[model samples]
Every structure is written in C-alpha cells, then in structure tokens.
Target: MKKPIILFVASIFLLFNKVYAQDKFTLEQCVSYALEHNLNIKQAKYTQAISEVNYSQSKLNLAPTVNANISQYNNFGRSVNQVTYAYSNNTTNNLNYGAGANWEIFGGLQRLNQLKQTKFTLMADQTYVEKIKQDVSLNVVNQFLLTMFGEEQVNNLTNQLKVSQEQLAIAKKKADVGTITEADYLQFKAQVANDETNLTSAQNQLEIASLELKQLLNLEPQQTFGIIRPSDAAMVEASKSAYEAVYVYNEALKINPSIKVAEYQSLASERAVSVAKGAFYPSLNLSANVGSYYSWNYYLPVDPANPNGPDYRPTFKDQYNTFLGKSINLSLNIPIFNGLQSRNSVKKAKISYENTKASEVLAKNQLNKTIAQSVADLKAAEKKYASAQISFESLKKAYEFSQKRFDVGLINSLDLNIAKTNYSKAESEALQAKYDMVFKSKVIDYYLGKPLTL
Candidate 1:
C-alpha cells in the first residue's frame, strides 16, 4: 500500500509539472514586460527627467531673487576721538543688517531667449525618449514573431518525424515477412535515424528561439514559455505603388521624434544667437530693503566732570526705533568695448546657428534616405515572398513523388533524401520571406502612424 501511494503521488507531481512547464505566453504580455523592465527604456526616461529639471531651472531664472545679510565688527587699538573713525586707542564696535530683493527689469531679452532655448531643448529630449520607446517596441515585435515562426517549424518537424517513424515500421514489417530486401529495410532505418536527428535539431532551435524571446523581454534566460501568434499572416498583395509607402514615410519624417528633436535644436540655436547678441544691450534691476538696528553703551570714568569720587555709572538706556523707507534707483549702463568680446560672441553664435540649420537639413535628408531604403526593402520582400510560395509548392510536389517512389523501390534513399532537403529548404525560405514581409509591413505602418495591434 505504501509503494502504491508513493507511485500515485509521483505521477500526480509529474502531471502538474508538465502543465506548469507548458503554460503559454502571448506577444503583448512580452512587449509590456519589456517596456517596464528594459534597460534602454529606463535610461531614456532618466534622460527626459533631467531635461525636465533643466527646464524648470530655466523658468525659475526669470523670478526675482531676495537675500538677507547681517554683520558685526569690533576693533580695539590706539584711540583717536576727533579724526578718522579708525581706532586709535579705540574700542569701536559697529553692527549692521539688511534685506534686499532684486528683480530684473530688462536684459536685452536675453533671459527670455534663454527660457525659449531651454524649452526647445526639453522638447527635444522628450522626443528622443519617445523614439527610444518606438525602437524597443519594434525590436520586441520582431523577436516575438520569430519565436512564433520557430514554434511552427518545430511542429512541422514533429509531423515529419512521425511520418518517418511510420514508414520505418512498415519497412521493418516487410523485412520480417521476407517481402522486402535487407537493403530496403536499411534505407528505412536510415531515414528513421535522420528524422530523429531532425527532431532533436528542431527541439534545440525551439529552445534557442525561446531564449531569444525571453532576453528581449528582460526575463530569465532559463524560462520556458510558448508564444501565441498575435498578428495576421504576411501580406500577399503587392503595394499599390512604389511611392505610396515612401510618401507615408516622408510624412512620418515630419513628426518622427528624431526629426522633431533636430527642429527644436535649430530653434534653440536661434534663441542662443539672440542670447549672445544680448551682450550689446543693457540690463536693469530694482532692489529695496527695510530693517532696524539697536545699540547700548556703558562706561566708567576716573575723572570726567566727576562727582562721587571718579564715578562709575551704568547710564545705559534701552532705546528702540522703527521706520519704513522706500527707494527706486535707476542704473544706466552704456556698452563699452571690451577687447571686442561682444562682437566675438555674436560671431560664434551666428556660426552655431548656421550649424544648427545645416544639421536640420542633414537630419531631413537622412530621414528621406531611410524612408527610401525601407521602401526598397519592402518591395524586395514582397517579391521574395511570392517566389518562395511558388518554390515551396513545387518542392512539396517533388517530395511527395519521391516518397512514393522510394516506398516501391523505384527510387533510392539518396534521391529521396535530396527531395526532402529541397522541401525543407523551400519551406524555410518561405517562412523567412513571410516574416520579412511582416516586419516590412510594420515599418510601413509605423511610418504611416498606424498603431500596432494584436
């Protein structure tokens, strides 16, 4: 009874393990996980946060500044009473405290320009973060799709293994009954060995695909999971026009995060030029403060109109006073030449502005080039997929014929093997073409601003 119970428990555990091991994973879940945990996306988010702080600083720069200060000084030296306040015999003490606020009235629009430039910079940084997100999503989609295709291949190989095993059994039975030659039975045996090898190879490829998908999702490499095919089959219809996708991509260039960033940078550069030119203009600031001070003194005299025998007296009195005052001061500064520093600044700023414009143009040109290349690739993949369809169909027919002939001894193992190889090659090529077309379609959709969906 103990042995039977132990065996039952072991079987139950094995059943549960199999169920757990075979749990399915979908593409959307994988992508979501990656977005949350991927290192590159996290880094991009940090960069955007830094840009936000910089922008806040730029805004705060325009606000008024207030400061308070207090100081007390004591001096003891040779005293002089009627001349300089400098201590002669002197014990002198002074105390002062004040509060002031300074608000910029004008600075040739320099502060405004600085604010504008930083705002544009912040926009650029944010766009860069979005671009990183889009890139990560694209990568995740590709890997996820590849894993699906790999699963399909593994299934196909398993079916082929089953067919080979069945054929080997038939050949073995015929040999036992002396109806088939030893050489023919040997051929079937060899075919079974090849099929088993192929099955092992397929398993290995499946593991590799699973690992790659897990890596993209930032999951542990040892994890095993199935991927559900999320998207439709590759588009078999050719594009209506070669320029259609290109036009869409061109539109995307207008809004593509990188291009937008470059545009913002150009504006920032223009603002920079204005800031630099501010050196030629003057600035004004207003400041005011209200405060109070107090003082107390005690002295002893040996002979100072003295009554009471060199009188010692505590004549210190508590005196307090408070007053409110206001002042508006105007400062005028005319620009004086300082080694042509202002002129050099303006020149450098103008050069930088020009460079920014050049970069903007370069960015646009690169965008156009990228679009053109992607369109070409899309077309090529479309054509390849069509060719692969034809090749795969023809190879399948040849394989079917070769299989029948080998069973009847009309074809040798070598011929059958060649046919099988051709079929496998054609099938793989067709699958690759299918995936390529899907990937290109995604690129087109991305350029067209289409949202990716399950």
Candidate 2:
C-alpha cells in the first residue's frame, strides 16, 4: 500500500517538473536557464569549482598533517619486535599503533605563494564562467531577434497573400465582363500564387528560427514555449550615436569578464614563478609522535617466567601507561645539485606569464576592433534606413495610385505589377535596415554590460 502511494506521488512530481520545463520563458528567464543548462557554461562552472577546491586545500597545506597506523605480526624464526626492537623466535600475536604529525614551518614561502596562486586561478576560473555565460546570453539574444523578425515576415506575407487574392477576384470579374484581357486576369492569379508561396517560405523561416532558439536554450525539440518581445520598437530606434564608441569600449574594458579572467591568470602565473623559486631555497619542518603497543601473547606485568613481568611483557593498559613513548624533531632540507628541475620550473612559469599577458593584449585589441567596426556599420545602416524609409513611403503611394488606376482601366497589368513589386522591395529593404541597425546597437549595449532583450 505504501509503495503504491509513494509511486503515485513520485509520478505526480515528475509530471509537474515536465510541465514546468515547458513553460514560457521571458528573455531574462531564458538567459538564466541557459546559464544553468548550457554545456559549456556547466563545464566552466565545474572548472571553477575545481579551482575553488584547490584554493581551499592549499590553505589546509599550511597546517600540520596527522596520521595513525596499526599492525600485528607472527614469526616462525627470529624477528625484531617493531615496537620494542627485541628479537623473538615464536609465533606472536602483537598489536602496534601510533599517531604522528608533520608540519612544514618554512619552505621559502612556497605554500604561501601556492595559496595565493590558487586563489587567483580560482578567481580567473570564476570570471571565465561569467564570460561563458555572457557569450551564451549574446547568442540567445541573436537567435531571439532572428525569431521575432522571422515571425513578423510571416505576418507580412500573410497580409500580402490576402491583398493579392482580393485583387485576383476583381481581375476575374473584369475579365468576365470583357473589361480586361484574359492575360491580365492570369497575371493576377500568378501574383496570388507567388504571395502564397512567399507566405509558406516565411513560415518555414519562422520555424527554423524557433528551432535555433530552442537549441540555444538547450531545450528538447519536442518541448514547446512562447517568447516575449517587449522592446522591439525601442530596439529598432536605438541610436549608437547617443553613446560615444570609445567611451563604451572603455566601459567594456573595465567590466568585461574575459579581460578580468586574463588579468587574474597573468597574476596567477606570476605567483607560479614565486612558487617555483621557493624550491631553490632550504625548507624547515617540525614533526612529533606519541605511541603505545601491546602483544596478545603477553600477560599482565605480575610474573617474569610467564611472559608477565613489571619490566617485561605486560597487559595492554600497563604497556600504554608504562611503555608509551613520544618524540619530536626539527629538520631542514637544503637544495643541493639535482637535475635543474627548479630552474626549468621557474623558466616555464615566466613563459606562461608572458603568454597570459600576450593573450590579454590580444583580447583587448580584438574587442576594440569589433566595437569600431560595429560602430561604423551602425552609422552606415542609419543612413541606409533613412533612405529605405523614404523609398518605401514613395513606393507605397505609387502602388496605391496604380491600384486605383488599374481598377478604373487607366493602367495595364504590367504597370500595376511593377508598382507592387517596387513597393514590396522597398519595404523589405527598409525592414532589413531596421533589423540591422537594431542588432548593431544591441552589440554596443552588450559590451556596455546592459541587459539584452528584444
């Protein structure tokens, strides 16, 4: 009864989880989900976790290590009693136990350097995790914009199909009344067919965009969810000129996780050199131990002939109280001639530090170039958008005039079709420019550490 009840409850919980996973995601929610689920981000988090563990263990390394040991022995011939260093010649049931601790008091500050280096590396790893998340967020933003654009294209094509179908009906009526040529009616029919085909294509594009968005979100293909576009108009009208490119780039330099990650890595490498140089100096360590042991074949310390004596074999308790031992030692290890491992390590660390410094330089240069290109492209797109808008408004008026003229038999089918085609081209070009400008502006926003949306 309990098993069945538990299974039913578990099934309900699983169903709830599945439903929640398919729930609609806002842009913020989507970004959060990707950070949680994206494989690259997950791996970066794991890497950061490993660095954290190393950093913590390095601190523990500064403290002493203690260990315990125990053993028993049987000997057919002469063998030394490990605990007392006495020779015995019979099978012996014995127990020996001890605990000892060793601590390195000084090692040219190597442990300190290691602790610092691991801490820096851990911070670098953490920053890299943020960098990976930002990358995934940007990708999600790109795909989100594409999906919305594709959906709008679908709506445009649907409207175009409706208008062409209505025009074809009017052309059919005119042809039946002998007011227009059969060929003209045929052109209207062809226009309707073309619009239908375009609508289908737009729908297909929308589906493809949605698929890409789902993939970026790390969602299963079968799961379904809706997206919200709360800032489409604002995005389209965003002006890069409002913010200076160099200022934005400089702001990115201050906050970008990739740069911080590189800087930390370079610092960690510098510490690595210190850790390696530590091996060139002498090390000092302190150690101590206290131990007591007993033999099973030995009796109480009350008899001499019977393996029981006050000064000989004794009970476990008597042995511990009377024969317990303790020792402490201080040792020093001086570096002599070994294979030049220390020198090579120091050399490798310096090289790594140099490489990290170079990577930081490269990252900064690339970011500057990318921002400059995006800014230039944005200005050009702004002009293009202005031109396309003007062209679209003019073409729209021309198409409206042609439609009225065709209805009153003042224009031929070719003239009407030409106006319609030009209008569609102008509208498409204008839309392309708008989205281009939107994307370019959003990039600057991304670099400036702003939220990505719409």
Candidate 3:
C-alpha cells in the first residue's frame, strides 16, 4: 500500500512539472527576462556604478584635508634638552602630539571644473547602460518574431497535410469502386506524401527557431518553451500604423540614449579642457596647526623655604597647558615652469574635445540614415503584404474550384495538383510578407521610443 501511494505521488509530480514547462510566454515577459539576464547589460551597469563612485569622489575632493600625529622619544646618552638647551647626562623621555589641516583656497577653479566633468561622465555612463538595454530589447524582438513566423509556417503546413490526407482517402474509395484510374488515385497518395514531407520540414525549422530564441534568453536546453502568438487582427492593426522618417528622426533625437551618450561625452570633454587649463593658473592654500609636548627628565628647582623639599616635575595637565602652541598659515604658488606639462595637457584636452564633437555629429547622422531606411522598408513591406494577401485569396478560390471539378471527374489530377501547388506557394508567401511587415513596423516603433509588443 505504501509503495503504491509513493508511485502515485511521483506520477502526479511529473505531470505537474510537464504542465508547468509547457506554459507559453508573452513578448513582454521574454524582453523582461532578457533584460535581467543579459551579460552585456550587467557589464554596462557595472561601468555606470564605477562612474557614480568617481562622481562622488570628485565632489569630495573640494573639501580640506585634516591629519593628526603622535610620537615618543627616549634618549639614553648625554643630549641637549629641547626645553632648556642644556646638556643632560641622565636618561630623558619625550612625547609629542599635533594636529593640522590644509584647505585649497584657490586653484583656478580646477576642482569645480573636475566636479562638472565627472558629473557629465556619470550621465554619459548612465545613458550607455540604457543604450545597452535598448539593444538587448531589439534583439529579443527580432528573435521573438522569427520564432513566431516559424510557428505559423508549421501550423499552415499541418493544415495542408490534413487536407491532402482527406483527399487521398476519397481517391482511394473512388479507385476501389472502379470510378477513378490507378494513376489518379496514386497522384492523391503522392500529394499526401509531399505534404507530409513539407510539414516535417516546417516542424524542424520551428524547432531550430525555438532553440535560437532559448539561447537568446539564456535558458537551459532541456527547458520546454512556447510563445503566446498574437492574433492575425492584432498583427494587421499594428502594421497599419505608419510613421514618417522625418518625424521618427526628430523624436528619436530627443530620447535616444545613444545620441544622448555622445552629447554628454562632448560636454564632459569640454569641461575636461577647462580643468586642464586651470593648471596654468596660480594656487592659494590655507593651513592651521596646534601641538604640545612633555619631557620626563626635566624638573623644577627645590623650594627655598622648605630646603629639603624634593625636586618636582610639572603635572601632565600643567605641562600640556604651558607647552601648547597654535599657528595659521596662508600660501600662494605661482606656476612658472614644469616641463610644459600643463600646456601639453590643455592641448590634448582640446583635441579630445574636438574628437567628441565630431563623434556627436556622426552619431546624429547615423540615426537619421537608419530612420529613413527603416521607414522606407516598412512602406515596402506593407505593399508586399497586401499584394501577397490578395494573391493567396485568389489562389485559394481557384484551388477549391479545381478540387471540386476533379471530385466530379471534370478535371484531371494534374490540373488539380497545379492549382493546389499555386495555392500553397501563395500561402507561404503571404505568411512571409505578413511577418516582414510586422517586424519593420516594430523597428519604426523602436526608433519612436514606443514599447515593442506582439
């Protein structure tokens, strides 16, 4: 009884797992998963984090530096006392403590400019991370659509195979009743075999597409995966929406992370030039210090009134108060000569600034070109899909008419096969055109900063 119960429990568990594995995923879910698991996005985020730290440190650099020090000294040989400048033969012990602070009052605004440069650098890095995410999302979209197309092909072929098998069954019956020739009946059998082959090929293609999508999502090979297919109406509706190249370019320029990254980098380079130029200017600093010390071997003279009074050393508190000293200083350093390092730095910075400015222009030009091409492709795909749809519908009606004529012995097997072949070709072409149109529309949406769906 116990063994039977355990077996039943195990079977139930396996069934549950199978059901869970077969669950379908929507496009949004796939995109979200890729975003979280993609290695490139993770690396980009790490770089952005480093930029954040640098930005923080640059701001902190403007603050003053404070330090404290302490030391102990023991002298065993004769030495001159620091306090009395007298020779001493006995052992002497001394302790010292001090604290000081230095503040940069001026440095040609170098610190300020450095802060600004880091801020812009951080912004650029942040935008770069977003750019990586956008790249990953687009990749996911492309793969997802490809997998969907494969599924549609498989489904269409499966339906065709069913219809061929049904016709073959009818042909066999007619042949047995001596109403159809053996060649005609055999032709129906051949049609069914060919459709079976096509269906198998489509299924294999679908499996390959699914595997590629799984790799993109970083999923285990053994994992069972399926996609939530969008309805035909949804796809048609999405394709109907149109975008102009100029409008898409204008919108993309405003929100595209790649373009923003270049602009921010340019700003950072400009600030870096200012920071380098600051090295040629004079600098001012302020400092403050306070210190005190004690000696163990030194003592005060004996009291005259009490002639036998023991010689006494000053108390620690008293010594500390008596020996304490404080000082403040202000210094100015004028830049004169240093191997012309500052001049060279400023020159390099200017050149870098120019490079970044050129890069900014290049990025904008590329974006414009891409937007124009995408819009053109989308229009072409729309026209192709429309033409394919009409062709498929016409072929479908012709094939139906020919099949009916063949059923009544009015048409030959060859004529029926020709009509069927034409219809099948049209069907495949229509499916291809439909997916192409959808993908191109999605590309336009991506440039316009719209969310990708279906």
Candidate 4:
C-alpha cells in the first residue's frame, strides 16, 4: 500500500510539473486570448446570441399563423348522428379534419413597430458585447503591465543579491588579512542574507502577478506563461495637452460602444412607446379554413339488389364530398375599454424612454470626465518619471563611491548598505514612474479607439 501511495504521489507531482511548463506570449496574444476566453466576455457573447435569436423570431412573427387539426368520436344508442345533425337511437361514428390560417392584416402597425423595437434592442445587445470585449482587453493590458513591472522588480533584487554576495566575499578576505573588523565581515554576510530574502519575496510577488494574468485569460492555476517585454523604443510616447485630450474625447464619442449601447436602448424604448400607442387603435384580421369529414352507422343496412347503400350508410368518398368546406373571413376589432391598460402601458413606455435617454446623457458625460482625468494622470506621471530619473542617477553615483570606500576598509558596512538601499529604492521608484506614465497613456489611447499595445 505504501509503495502504491508513493507512486501515486509521484505521478501527481509529474502531472503538476507538466502543467507548470513555461511559455511566453506577446501583449497582443494576451489580450486576444482574454477576449476569447474570459468568462465575463463569454457571458456577454451569450447575451448577444440570445438577442440575435429573438430578433429573428420577431421578424418571423410578421408572417401568418397556420394550424392543422383532426378528431374522431363514436357514440352508442340515442346518440345524435353528426352527418344529419339529428337525434336517433342508433350507434354512430364521426370524423373531422381541417387546416386553418389567420393573419393580422392590420394592428395599428404594432407588429411593424415591435419589429423595429426588437431590431434596435438587438443592436444595443451587440454594442454591449463589444463593450465587454473592450473591458476585457483593458484589463488584460493593465494586468500585463503589472506583471512586467513585478518581473523587473525581481530582476533588480536578483542583481542586488549578486552584488551583496560579492561584497560578502570581499569582506571575508579582508577579515582574514586583519584589515576589516570581524563584526563588519559578519554584517556584510547578514546583508547578503537580507538580499536573498528580498529576492525571494520579489519573486513570489512576480509569480502572483503572473497568476492573476492567467486567471484573466481563464487558464488553469498551474499553467505557466511569460509576457514579452517591449523594447524602450517600441513603447508608445504619446503626448497631448488638454485641448488634444478634448479632441480625442469628441472623437471617441462618435464610436464608443457604451455610448452606442445607450443610444440604441433609448431608440428601442421610443419604439416601445409607439408599440404601446398602437394598442389604442383598431386591429384587422383575415382567416381561412378548409376541411373534410365522415360518419357511419353500423345499425343501418345495405341493399344488394338496388346496388346502393341504405340511408345513413354512405360511401366514404361521398361522405367526404358532402362534409368538405372552405371559407374566408375579415374581422375588425375596435378597442372600447380595457381597464386603462393601453393608457398605462403608453405612460410606462414613455417613462422608460426618458430614463434611457438620461442614461445616454450620463454615459457621454462619464466618458468625457474619464478622458480628462486620464490626461491629467498622464502629465503627472510624466513629471514623476523625470524626477525619479534625476534621483536614481544621483543615488547611483553616490552608491558607486560608497562601494569603493567599503572595499578598501575606509567605510563601515552600515554606511555602504545605506547607500545601496537608497540606490535600489530610487531604481524601483523610477521604474514605477515610467510604467505609470505608459499605462496612463495607453488608457487615453484606448479611449481614442486605438489598438491597445505596449
């Protein structure tokens, strides 16, 4: 049993290892995969599909209705014969079959208006699908940037660990030669350990970031993947003032999916009002039916000499010819009163239309505000990047000087560590500023109907 359990565990570990195999993808691949597989996007697609079906069905509703029916019955003594429409004390059998059609020739144009309303509602649903895709794309882009940032942070820590390891070796040599104090050598060793700890933490965070990205793509937790980092020159360097931002906002308004959804929904609601008003007018309809029927009575007798059936015992063909019928009708239904149903319906539809119109206004307003805020954030991030650049450069120079002094036993480990720490912090902050600027710019571009890229 123990052997079998061990084997099972080993196999499971191997399977997990296979699942964790590494792969790399570019930004476009990430966004595309998320768009195709994200649960939220898939759900939105389902809604769009349902709307498409409903639109087709609504168009079909404009056609006439047709139905076929057939029935049969048998009666005992004292039953009325269906063929004669008279009562008799004799067994009888009857059969009936027919096809009928009905069409609303006119219903205050409600059918046509309802079709238009369904069409507009379908358009709204289509726009909603596009909006969900855009949202997923934006989310993927943001998460991809964050993962890259975390990966770079881990690289920085790894480099710092290497430098700390080198310092520890130098401090050990100096202590052996009695040039550096034992306490100082021990401190350098401790700094190396701390660097290792920081590297491990940074790596864990990078892994978490990668996992979050995989979740967005609807991948399994054990799946392993990496993002292709764009080179510095390939990164976008978009610049826009408030005026340009406003122009972009106006351009976005022309095609934004969310705004389109609101507009279409409002139109659909207006059509609904028209449909409700139609209920107040008279409706016209046309109907037609054709059928054949038969009946028989076993109690009746047949005459051989006369070469003819007795009364009430007719031939099947003769009975069908006698019972067959065809008719057409035209009807008009003028509405009188219905407990104020039509009035209430029109009122409710009007209110719904007003609400949808307001929602459209809100959508446009929110879009404008978002664009303006994004522009402001981009400018702020630009300034931050410049300041961080200056700070990192100065700290780099100071740290280099500190490293030289510490190598020659002219400075304590504490002083050298302080300089190293400051330099690392500045590097991290600078990188953050750079990415923030890039992300903000991407958001503005996204709103401008530009393809999302690194």
lDDT of 2 by residue, 150-207 (tens): 8777787788888989889988899999999999999888888888887898788888
**TM-scores for candidates 1 onward, in order:** 0.78, 0.88, 0.80, 0.88
Estimate, for each residue in 1-454, the C-alpha lDDT of model 4 and write its tens digit.
8999999999999887776556578899999889888999889889889989988988988899999998988788887677667889977777888999999999988989999999999999999989988888888888898888898889898999998998889888999998888988888888898889888988898888888899999998876687889885467354333436688789999989999999999999999999999999999999999998777553234565654566356677876787789999999999999999999999999999999999999999999998888888888887888899899999999999998987676888889988998999999999888778888887887788889887
lDDT of 3 by residue, 1-454 (tens): 9999999999999999999778898999989988898888889999999999999999889999999999988878898776687887867798888899999999999999999999999999999999998888888888888888888898898899999889889889999998988998888899898998988988888888888778777877688999998888977787777788999999999999999999999999999999999999999999999999888865775795875778888888878898899999999999999999999999999999999999999999999999999999999999999999999999999999998898788998878988998999999999999989998998888888889887
RMSDs, each prediction? 7.0, 3.5, 5.1, 5.1
Clashes of 2: 1
Q: Give the TM-score of candidate 4.
A: 0.88
Q: Give the winner by TM-score: 2 or 3.
A: 2
Candidates' lDDT values, in order?
0.75, 0.84, 0.90, 0.86
User: By the lDDT metric, which is better: model 2 or model 3?
Assistant: 3
lDDT of 2 at 267: 94
Report the backbone clash tally of model 3.
0
**How accurate locally is residue 255 in candidate 1, as Cα lDDT from 0 to 100?**
73
Name the runs in model 4 displaced over 4 angstroms.
1-23, 74-79, 88-92, 173-178, 181-183, 236-243, 296-317
Worst 10 residues of 4 by lDDT: 236-245
C-alpha RMSD between model 3 and the true structure:
5.1
